[model samples]
Target chain A: MGREDKAMVKKAEAATGADNRPFLFRRHDAGTIREAYRKMLLIRAFEEGAENAYMRGLVHGTMHLSIGQEASAVGVGLALRDDDQITSTHRGHGHSIAKGAEVKRMFAEFFGKETGYCRGRGGSMHIADVSKGNLGANGIVGGGIPIAVGAALSARRLGNGKVVVCFFGDGANNEGAFHEALNMAAIWKLPVVFVCENNGYGMSTSQARATASATIAERAGAYAMPGRTIDGNDLSAVAEATEDAVSRARNGEGPSLIELKTYRWRGHSKSDRNRYRTKEEIDHWMTENDPVKRIEADLVAFGILDEAGLDAVRASVAEEIEAGIAFAKESPSPDPADLERFVYTEGA
Target chain B: MDQPVRELSYAEAIREAMAIALERDERVVVMGEDIGVYGGAFQVTGDLIERFGPDRIIDTPISELGGAGIAVGAAVTGLRPIFEFQFSDFATLAMEQIVNQAAKMRFMLGGSVSVPVVMRFPAGSGTGAAAQHSQSLEAWFGHVPGLKVVQPTTPEDAKGLLLAALEDPDPVMIFEHKLLYKTRGPVPEGAYTTPIGKAEIRRKGRDVTVVATGVMVSRALEAANELAAEGIEVEVIDLRTVRPIDTPAIVESVIRTHRLCIVHEAVKTLGIGAEISARIAESEAFDYLDAPIVRLGGAETPIPYNPDLEKAAVPQVPGIVAALRDLATGRR
Candidate 1:
C-alpha cells in the first residue's frame, strides 16, 4: 500500500478508539453490526454473481453494478424502517438488497422470468418491491427525486409517519428535478432524506467536470435543508450521517441531504471500457478502500466476530447467491398471449 | 316525475365535481399553479380553495415537471391527486412524468401499483391566448398507452367524467376546452359517474355521421341544425373519450348513415380524426361506406393570435356545414 493509503487507514482505525471497539458499537449492537456486515457481503456477492452470469451469456442487456458502494446503500437502509420507503437509481442492486428485496426474485427479474419483482416487465433498471417500501429504481437521471418527495407528501397527508429516502448519483444533482424536489420537500416539511452517492464519476465524466457546485451536499442549502458529506467507505460514518438525516425527516423537520463520497471498482456499466480513469486509481480503491474489506477488518478488530465467523458469513452469502441464480434459471418466462395484461389496470 | 332541472357553466360543473370527490374521498387533492386564491388561469378552480382549504386545493409553484411528478408519486403511494396544467401547451414541459412515469408506472411495476391520478388540461383555441396557450393536445395523450383521455362537451359530462376519472384506478387525462368554460348546460346535483370510453349521440339522423370531439361537437350540432333546413340530415356524435374510443358507437352510426365526417380542433394530419377514420376503415363499417370518409380539423399551423385567423384555423360552424353538406349530398 502507498504511504498516503497507510496513513488514511490509520486515521480510520484511530476513529474507532484505542481499545479497537468500533465507534458504531456505541449506537449499534454486535448483532446489528454483524447483520450489516452480512448485508454488505450479500450486496457484493450478488453483483459478482450477476457479473458472472452476464459474462456467461445468461443475462441480457446491461447493468450498472454498485460493486464498491455497498456501504452507502446498507448504511442508509439500516437507518430506515421496513415501512419507510425509498426510490432507487439505475445502479440500484445494492439498494434493493439493502431495502429487503429477495435476491432470488431480483435474479428472477434479471433473467426476465415471471417470478421476478416486476414479473419480467421491468428488468435491471426498474426492479421494485413496493410491499417492502421500495417504490422502484428509475432509469432516468433525477427521475426518482420528485417521486420520493411525493411519497413523503403521501406520508404526511395520510398521517402514516413513514419517512422516504431518495437515492441518486452525483450526476443527478445537475438535474432540475433534484432542485425542484428538494425545494418542495423543504417548503412542505415532508419527511424525506436525499442521499447522493457521489462515486467520483458519472459514467466517464468526473463530478468536477459536470457539477457547478463544490459539493452535491452544498447544493442542498439552496433548498433550505441540512446537508452533510462523509466518508462513504466507512460504514460507521455513513450509518451515523444517514441516521441523523432520517431522524430529522421523521421529526417533520423537512428533508436533509447526505452526500456519501465513495468509488466504484468496476466500470460504469458492462459496456464501459474504463478509459476515463487510470488503472492505478482503480487499484488504489479496490485494495485500500474496499467497503466490504473495511467493515470485515473493523468486525475483527472490534472482537465482534472472529475469522471463522466471517468465513461462515461469506459461505452463507455464496450459497444464497447460487440458489438465487438457480431459482431464476428454473423460473418460467412470461407468456406471449398476455403481453398487454399490465399495460393498464384490468377492468378500469 | 322528472328530476329538478339545474343549469351550470362548464367551469362550475368541474368545480362541483372536484368538491364531490374531495367530500367523498379523503385522499383526493387538487393542485396546480394559481389554483388557490388566484382561482386558476381560467377560473375553473374558483373558490375551491375556500371550500377545501389550501391543503387539499394546493397552489404549486410554476414547476410543471416537478409538480406533475409529485402528483404521480403521491398517487402511487395512495393519494389521488388531480393536477391541473395552466395551459394544455405547458404539458410539453411535463411530458416525461406523464408519459414515462405515470403512464408506465403500473406496467413497469408489473401491476403492483396503479397511478390513480387525474390531470386536467385547459385546451383549445379562440381565447386570443396565442399559439402557446391554445392547443388541442388530447391526441398527444391519446396516442400514449396506459392513459385514459377524455373530452367533455357539456356541463353534465364534465362533472360526470371527472367523478368517473377519480374512481378509475388508472391515470386519466381530461382536456377541457377554454372557450366552453362559460357555456351553460343542465347538470345534476350530487355525485354521478359518466362511463368513460363511451360516445354520446348528441343528435340523430340518417344521412351523414358527424363524429366530433370537444368544441367541435357544438359546432357540428350547429351545422346539423342549419343543414336540416336544406333537407340534409346529419347525425352528430360526441366522442367523449379519445383513447379507448367508443368504436362501436361510431361504427354503428356510420353503418346507418353510410357516410362519415370526423371533426376536431387539433390538426387534421394526425389528430384523433385520423385514428377514428382508420378504426372505421379497418372495422366492419368500411363496407357500409357510401362515400369516402371526410375529416374537417384545424389547419396545419399554430393557432394564430388574430380573431379572424384563429376562427379560420379550426373547424367552425360554417366549415362543418360545408364539409357535412359536401359529404351528405354526394358532392365529395
Candidate 2:
C-alpha cells in the first residue's frame, strides 16, 4: 500500500482485530526473555539517569535520549551477530547498549572523562565502539545513511557475509542522501537494511508536516525494494522483521527498508521545555504502549521471574552506573599537548 | 624519443590523466554531481562513463556534503576516489568533509588507514561565471594540515601533478583554472608521477627572484622578458605544490638574485605570498634581500565581472612587470 493508506489500515486493524499475538514457542526459554527485558530496563534507567544529570548541570554538551524506544534498539540489536555492522542516530543510547557498550564507559563518556570511548572528545552525538560494530552515532541528519551504504558496499565486494543495519529517523527520509543511498544499495544489491525508526518527529517538525507520505517505509517501493513497518513496541515483531531483512541481505538479496514505529520518551535534547509535544500525549503512551512495561507484564504472565528478580536487576544496574560515573569522575582529562598530537601521521 | 601526441590543453591533460588512472587502477573511481553521464561542468571528465561504466564513473546527487562524506568513507574502505567539485565556490559545501574528516581520519585512527583521495576543482576566475562559480580557494586548503595542495598551470604539470596525487598516500586537492584548460603545452604519453612538495624553476635569470604559482607562473615569465629589455634579469619559479612548500628553491634563488617578489592569484592579505614573505623574512635569505620582499596577489575585493577589473583583481602581466622593476632597482 502507499504511505497514505498505511495509517488508515493500521487504525482499522486497531478497531477490529484482537491484539496480534505470536504462536507460543514449544522451547522458548524464560531466561532469554528476562535478559532482554533486563536490557530494556537498563537502557531506560541509564537514559533517565543521563537526563537527570544533564538537568543538574553535570553532563557536558547535549544528549538525545531513547527512553521510549527501547524495544526497537534491543530487538534489532539482538537479532544481529557480533560481526554485523550498524549505524545509529543521535538518539542512540539504546542502540549502543544493544551493541554491548559498558554502562560505565557510556557514563564516563557523557561525563567527559578520558576513560570514555572517544576519549571524551565526541559527545553524545558521536559515541562509537567499532569493536562492537557500532560505526557511530551521527550528528547530521541523513548523515549515517551514506556511510552505512559504503560499509555495505565494502562487505558485498569483499564477500564478507556481513550485513549493515542503518538506523535513521523519519526526518532523514526527507533528505536526498536517504534516497540516494537507498537507490544505490538497491541497484548494487548491497548487503544493507535501511532501518527507519519512525518516531513521530524529526526534531521540532512533526513527521506529518515534513513528509508527504504516511510512512517512510512505503516510500521504499519507488526503489523497488521490500518495505515493512512493525509495531516497534513489540519486541517479538521487531526482532522477526529485522531478522528477515538481515538474513535476506546476507543471502544476496540486496537491501530492505524496515520502518520501526517507535517514539522518544524524553525531549529532543537535554533542554527541552515541552513546547511542541503535550503531557497528555506523553501520558497516553506511558499508560498504554510502554515497551518495557509490556514486556515485563508479558514475562510475568508467562511465569518468568517475579518482582524480586526485577528489583535485583534494577539495583545491580544502578550500582554499575554509579561506578561508571565514579570512574569518569576520577579519570584524568587529556593533556593540552595531546590536542596537537593526532592531527597527522608523524612519519611514514 | 618521440612524444605520443601533439600539444594538449591543461584541461585535456587532466582528462587523459584521469582516463589513464581509471584504466590502470580498478580501485580508482570518479564521482561528482554532473561528472558521470553529464560529462562534468567543464567537460574535463567528458564521456568517462561510456569508457569506464557507471560503477567507476559515478554521478552523485547534488548533495556535495553527502558526496564528500561518502568519498571519505569509501577512501577509508580502500577505494581511490577522485571527487570533483563543479567549481571552487561549491567547495564551501564540502569543506567539512575535506577539512575536518578527510584531513583528520589518518591521525585519529592512529595511522591505521591512508586517505588516498584526490579532489579536483575548477578554481580561479576567467570564465565569467560570476561570484558563485569562480573562486580560488586552494590557499585555504593549503593552510590545512594532512592535505597535499597543488595548482598546475600547464598541461604537462596537470598530467604529472594528477599522477603524483594518485600515488601519494594522502588527500590531494588539485585546483585547475578554467582559463588554462585550452592553453596547450607538451605532455608526455603514458603514466608518470611527479614528486610532490617540490618546485620547478620554469625560467632562469639573475637580477630578481620571481616566485609564482598557478596561472601567475606564465605571467611572471612574460614579466621577466619585459624586464630583460631594461637590463634587469629575473628568475621564475613555479610552486607546483603549494603546501610543504619548497622553501629551499625560493631561498636559493633569493640568495643569488638578492631580491624576492612572491606572486599569486589570491588576495594579497594573508595569502600564500604572505606566508612566503614570512618564510623568507625568517630564513637566512633575509640578509640577502637588497630590497624588501614584495607580494602581488588579488585585490582585497570581490572578483569583478568586467574583464579589465577582473584582470586588476589578480596579478596581471603588467603587475608582475612593475613589481619586478621595483624589486630589481632595490625599491620597495
C-alpha TM-score for every candidate: 0.97, 0.83
Residue lDDT tens for model 1, B1-332:
14465999999999999998998899999989999999999898999999889889988888888999999999999999999999999999999899999999898888899999999999999999889999989999999999999999999999999999999999999999998999999999888899999999999999999999999899999999999999999999999999899999999999999999999999999888899999999999999999999998999999999999999999889878998999998899
Candidate 2 residue lDDT tens string, A1-348:
223353454466579884333321112367766677778988998897887788788877888899889999988886788888888888888888888888777777787766777676666776777778887777778777877887776676556788889999988999877887788778778899999988898777888899998888898899889999888998877888888899999999989999999888777886778688888888888878898887766555444667787788778878877776778778877666677554554552
Give the DockQ-based CAPRI class for model 2: acceptable
Backbone clash pairs for candidate 1 read none
lDDT of 1 by residue, A218-288 (tens): 99899899999999988988998989989888888889999999999899999899999999999999998
What is the docking quality class of candidate 1? high
How does each model score on lDDT?
0.93, 0.81
Worst 10 residues of 2 chain A by lDDT: A19-28
State the iRMSD of every prediction, in order shown: 0.6, 3.3
Name the lDDT of candidate 1.
Answer: 0.93
Report fnat for all candidates as fractions from 0 to 1: 0.75, 0.25
